[model samples]
Target: MATSFNEQFDQHGAWRREFSLRLKLLAEWLKDHDLLDAAVAERLRRLEIQVRSDKLMVAFVAEFSRGKSEMINAIFFAGYGRRIMPATAGRTTMCPTEMGYDPEVPACLRLLPIETRLQPQALMEWRMVPEKWTRVDLDVNNPQQLAQAFERVSETRKVTQEEAHALGFWHPETPEDNPVSDAQGMVEVPRWRHALINIAHPLLKQGLVILDTPGLNAIGAEPELTVSLIPQAQAVVFILGADTGVTKSDLSIWREHLLPESDQEDIRLVVLNKIDTLWDALSTPEQIQSQIDRQKASTADILEISPSRVIAISAQKGLVAKVTKDAALLEQSCLRQLEDALGHGMLDQRQKILGSAMARGVSHLRCETERVIQMRKRDLTEQAIELKGLHGKNVSVIRHMRSRIAQEQSEFDQGGSKIHAVRSVHLKLLREVFALLGSKALKAEMAELTQALGQKGLKLGIKRSYSDTFDKLRSHWTRVQGLIGEIQSMLTAMFRQLNAEYGFALQVPDQPDMGACLAEMEEVQRSHLQYLSLGNTFKLAQPEFAERLVRALSTRLRGIHESALGDVELWSKSAAAQLDVQLRERRQSFVRRMDAIDRIQQAAGGLDERVQAIDQQIAHLDQLEEKLASLAERLVSAGDTVAAAQEPLSA
Candidate 1:
């Protein structure tokens, strides 16, 4: 049997996974060879994360009752053998609902209360507290429980005019924009501001995020969704009611929201939903096609795009067909064409996106590695020429050069003790710094912070808990700073000693900006109190939130620790380089004088042997240069393949 569209999507996902792994391996290779600069390697590492973790965000935007949720259920969650999302007969999924898999959090429906939006704190910070969100446990096997849990998104609450104003839902000039007021003048509004469905669905696990948004009001109120989510989405599917063609509200959404945010024409898809209404049993197939083609042309004209971009489908029929395994209904649904578009359009586009991203990261590194290799080859070529020129001379000259070499060797041998002393000092300073920033101590401190943040049943609430936790973390930062200063002092003393004893004037470079290392953590601290409030006990207790907070803080701490270690390593290498330079200068001076003596003594026997030895060294350098060049070529070619590679779905 031919591969189904769903299986093809899985194959595409597997391709991405395989590509990401290859990039990871290449990053390690670059690091191992020291081919790229440290920053380049870091960029590669970050790219690996984006490749591996970034979900293909497909947002479904429409007015209520357009079957947007049903489309999502049919296309992605059909494997469940039933409708997983709440797609009832009437208006369902009233809020801006997001279906995803947060591996850190368990399967549950986390709903943020609409009232929480009125809080002084930013939405993201407010979202951090679990207690602020209503948690509904979801059992996948028990479809009833799952269905009930998801139904909460449609829940509503009634509030007085004053209460609505307090919740930022009422504006005097735009009074009509507020939820319809009853005879008593109380406004009925959605109970939840946002619904996050965390489920163990296959498509979600494969990194698919479906954003089902209601009307403009919800999208307008939620700045995060408009400013961040919509703009970042990989594809935005705008749903239009086939019966209504294009309503005023739909036009407003198309003009105001979707069009402005989605810059890529290919990523934006127009779905004329409820197409089953267009299906007439008495009409010929050509007649139906003619109507659809006209609708497609009209939609394309309205949206100012090619007619091919508009897709007509019956999401309800699609869902029913998939659930019942009825091929006829499925074909009537025209969902296969939509799936084909998604596979070829969005999924194919994702490969290009990943490729372009990877190319941007790897190109410079490849060029630089190639340059370094070529430069080394040039230097070796010069050395080879000089060695070949030294093939013949007098015996007396050779003996005199040997005597001078002996004298220089004695002087070189004497400087070894000073080299040892400098090295010892550098090693001692590095060891002490690593000991102070030991992983065990850092891990223990992080564990304590996690425990404090995890403290349940706090009378003072989440704000106080985070405040206390951050303060403790700040103390650890202070201790780390003090130890870093101590290490700097030791390095300075060591460098000063070397300069005084040897007249080398070696200076320890100033320490890198430690403040910059902890700057991200400090920025988070400045507004830590703004993150949590009195009513976030449950939000604070969520395993996902806890793990995320811990991971973020731990990453910063690790960065600082790594920064300190890097600084030490850099300083040590600098000190050793200076010593090597002085030693090389002394030896070179001795060799130059010895060459003059050899000329005077007329001793140049065995010069051919010297030439042969030099040739062997040149051959070794040539092989190394060739290997480096080959690796650079491979990196560039791999980047090209990644950038251009696409998995074309069967039409």
Candidate 2:
């Protein structure tokens, strides 16, 4: 045999319990890591425990005189014989209150007063002596205790203005304050704030918490109820009189507050109450049916529900019929529909629990992964510190070398004769080199080479910016010549002064011989100039000599020449290796994480599809339940009418 809906529901309930336990463990991990805020962590902890415990909280809300308390008493107690909840012509509940199962506890009425004249123990004793105080508490283990508690809390005697002011129920008196003579001017005191009363009842023990909220106006007037109680509620049922249909106030409740996009969905349930009035309205049967159809259609368009789902109920009649087994009374009443709707709603809650559990599991996993990644990043940063230190040391060594070379060059120039001679030779060679390097013949040869190279190198000229390169080289050479000229001029002046003082002619040497000191320097300049003019440096020994000379000259003056080249090669290799390894590792990690995520998503998807299927089944079952309840009411009503006719004959 296939599993029944209730059986499936029970299984899902059990799964949710297990899931909640796991989520709690995950939340503990998050708290340990300081990954969540304290308040958010606390909320998650509470939600986890709430899911595991599987408690159902039903709030009864409505405008004043809409039979909210009477309905709760009738359905919950099966009759008003004992009057478990106080219901009167005016507002019976002066503040928000709660009732639930706790039979092992003593009966008590806990009051949280804004200001109090009586002590806690004194208020507890006041149930037996209601005329002595404004409120009281009583132990509810017996009928006598229950009666006493109710009487104590319900006593409505007016207090003197002075008494009211003393209790903080009225504004403080002032010199300009005028006392009004009318009863309307008197300040009304709210009886409770955060009261917790224990009731010793059999039905209350079945995981039920009935929140009896004050009327809309009263709730609006109270800041605590609006800010705290309503938000704290896991589920809320808004009751409206069906006899009057949707009123401005009813629409206001939904539009202004309840129907907004809440973080949680499906928390609010709207109840069209007091539907028995429909039966008394005078009209032909056709006219009445047409009106009901029209009203239902209108409601469907407005509330986005099928007319059949909008239950029209008479709370008073349904409670009597449930106990009496009179189908006729039930048929004439709408209470049966309301009961069916509530039952369906309870089943729907089970789905919400399962969804929340799965969501928490996914969230926990993501948070855990993020925490681990952050820790890894910190470790990598510590490892990178060594690289920075090495770079700084290299920069200092290069700078020291450059300073030493500059000091040596200055010392060599102090004699004036060597400086004059070296500068004159350098200037002469520079002029000759420029004449050789910058010529029409060389330019024409370079242009032809460029054109030939362009054809060979993918149809572009040498794959380089020749004009910019030539301009930059010429600018550098010009600056070097100017420096050499300045040195020469200074040396000439110093040498002339020395010659005048000593009366001897000093002869400046010509350019240094290529075969003598710095043989590499002569080879380099000659080879480089040849390359520029002829477009090639094919001689092996000369080219090698050119590279050696350039390195030797620059090394003493700028240590960066050697270190820069070495650093460039080292960084390029290191970067390539590091990037390759990281890329491969990242690819593998990405694949692994993606696979894990895919599996989770697939599992969640399967669960979602199953849940949707179950939801459809549940909806079908609800419709059947509604139809069965309607049929039962009709049958009972017909039987009652037949019995009445037979009674007349028997009499």
Candidate 3:
């Protein structure tokens, strides 16, 4: 049987568990070793806990009066008696609100105030704080309170002008005060600003985080929401009115912000809202369908959708359809496409989570192994230095022996003629003695050393398993590269549109340059021959050993080979102390080079991370650009009439 979405989710859960375990271990090690800063350690601990917890986060985003809150209540809290979230026409959510499933207590409406734009915690302090100033915690179990919350003209606090100005709810006129504004004449104070309500329903606490956004003027007008929230969102659902299949505003939003460009393709879903309006319009069903299809085709051409996956739905009707079993037809007609989109999105997310986790694990293991190997190399280098020193000392000893023999030969030459017979005997003996200490003898010893060195080199050759690991890593990287490329292309197109709309220049880096690093590696490989020259030279030497002696030495070296054959052992011991010192220095150089490579890898990885973060920030900036553009245009238009009014008498 094919794998189900649930099965994929389960696999992701298992990997998450593994990731949590590994992270826990890493945290503990860092703590014990005092390696990480306290704050970082705390963050890791929190992340570990979060990974293990099965909490799902679903955020709702739409223009004001799109019934986002109503949809939330209907889908998750139908059995609950009260409407947990307050949904009304015209900018209902003055601030972003979240709801979830909490069964331990009765339904409650908690209003959180926005004192300043800060972290998510800023709203938490005001949650359930008071009854006035748009702050209230009501018992939602009672239908009366739920109904009261939804009413457009409830007993809500009216903010004074001073309060609005203080809270940054008032529009700024000057260019210096607000970069998003036009020259100093167009400022309008909205009446319904600074009103925020947060409701906690039993269903909300379960696994949903709803963001009830205001209209284009509210959501797009602010840099905070555009630059922070939406880009970070896992999925974005754009709600459009079905009656206005693709309105100027809807198209504007898609073209300016949501559509995938050269640099990004973050998941986006579009819902043609108010589909019930299409049921009995003057247009026939076939005509309406054709219109929708045409619109879809046009949008696909602009936004790059392949199969045209727009869903036509009535948020108001879908809420009603959820309750009755007979409402399947209605529900299917309205929400089946959206359901499919959500399901596919969820499944893709699951795969991404698992894949990222696995990649992280492999990266961690590779780093650890590299560190260990470097340390071992260092130890080997130290030993090589010692062995080189011993070899030098042995050379010095041989030289001294040659000097002594020379002196003896000089003495023998001086006592000539009368001791001709003695001279001849001495000459023969001298020749035999010289032969014992000849270059041939030295070469024989050198040959043995070369063979030992070769054996050591073989040992140092990277294991086949490591090669396999690298191959897998490369394959994984290839996939990541492709995905990143697609995302990058999407972002590029989006950025271009934003630049054109807002008149702000944005230059995106084309495919990042990995060539420099690759070239460096190539250079290193090219120099390998020079690096191996010393060993090669030693191997070329001819050894002058008798058969018996050669056999004896080979057997002896083989016996102690495990201990003294490799570069580690060769450098560790000292037959000639000078040779050992030189070897030690060379080993140190090798270790340093390896360390450099490790640092380079780490730097590259960090660069990749930073690029990803920048991409996210850029997406946020694009959203902000759209909002600012709209506000600026409005300000300019508003200022035009005022300028005319202030003009002197016509010349």
Clash statistics: count for each candidate: 16, 8, 49
Error of 2 at 469 (Å): 62
Candidate 3 ranges with C-alpha deviation above 4 Å: 1-47, 53-60, 74-83, 88-91, 100-135, 138-208, 251-265, 281-288, 295-307, 362-651
Model 2 local distance difference test score = 0.46
Model 1, C-alpha of 357: deviation from truth (Å) = 2.9
TM-score of every candidate: 0.64, 0.41, 0.43
TM-score for candidate 2, please give it: 0.41
1-651, model 2: which lDDT tens digit per residue? 222223343444544454455456555644554444433354455556655555556677777667777677666655324556677777677666667655554556665553433232222233344344333456554555565465333333345665554442333423122223256556455554334456644434434566776665444433223323454355666776766666765664554334443434335666666666665557775776566666666765676666765655677776667567777886656565555455455545545544544454344334333433333333233223322222324445535534543563454346446535755564564454444334332344334433433342322232233333344434544454454345445545644754454222332212112122123323223333323232122211132222322222222212222222222223222222222333333344334333333433344434243334434644554553343334323322322232321221100
| RMSD of candidates 1 onward, in order | 12.0, 38.0, 33.2
Candidates 1 and 3 compared: the better one by lDDT is: 1
Per-residue error at 394 for model 2, in Å?
A: 54
**lDDT by candidate, in order shown:** 0.65, 0.46, 0.43
Cα error of candidate 3 at position 90, Å: 4.4
Candidates, ranked, lDDT = 1, 2, 3
Give residue 559's lDDT in candidate 2 (0 to 100).
25
lDDT of 1 by residue, 535-633 (tens): 223344544345445554555456567766675555445445544544554455456445544543454534455446546756765675566455445
What's the CA error at residue 492 for candidate 3, in Å? 39
On TM-score, the candidate that comes out on top is: 1
The residue-by-residue lDDT of candidate 3 on 491-510, one tens digit each, is 45644653454232333333
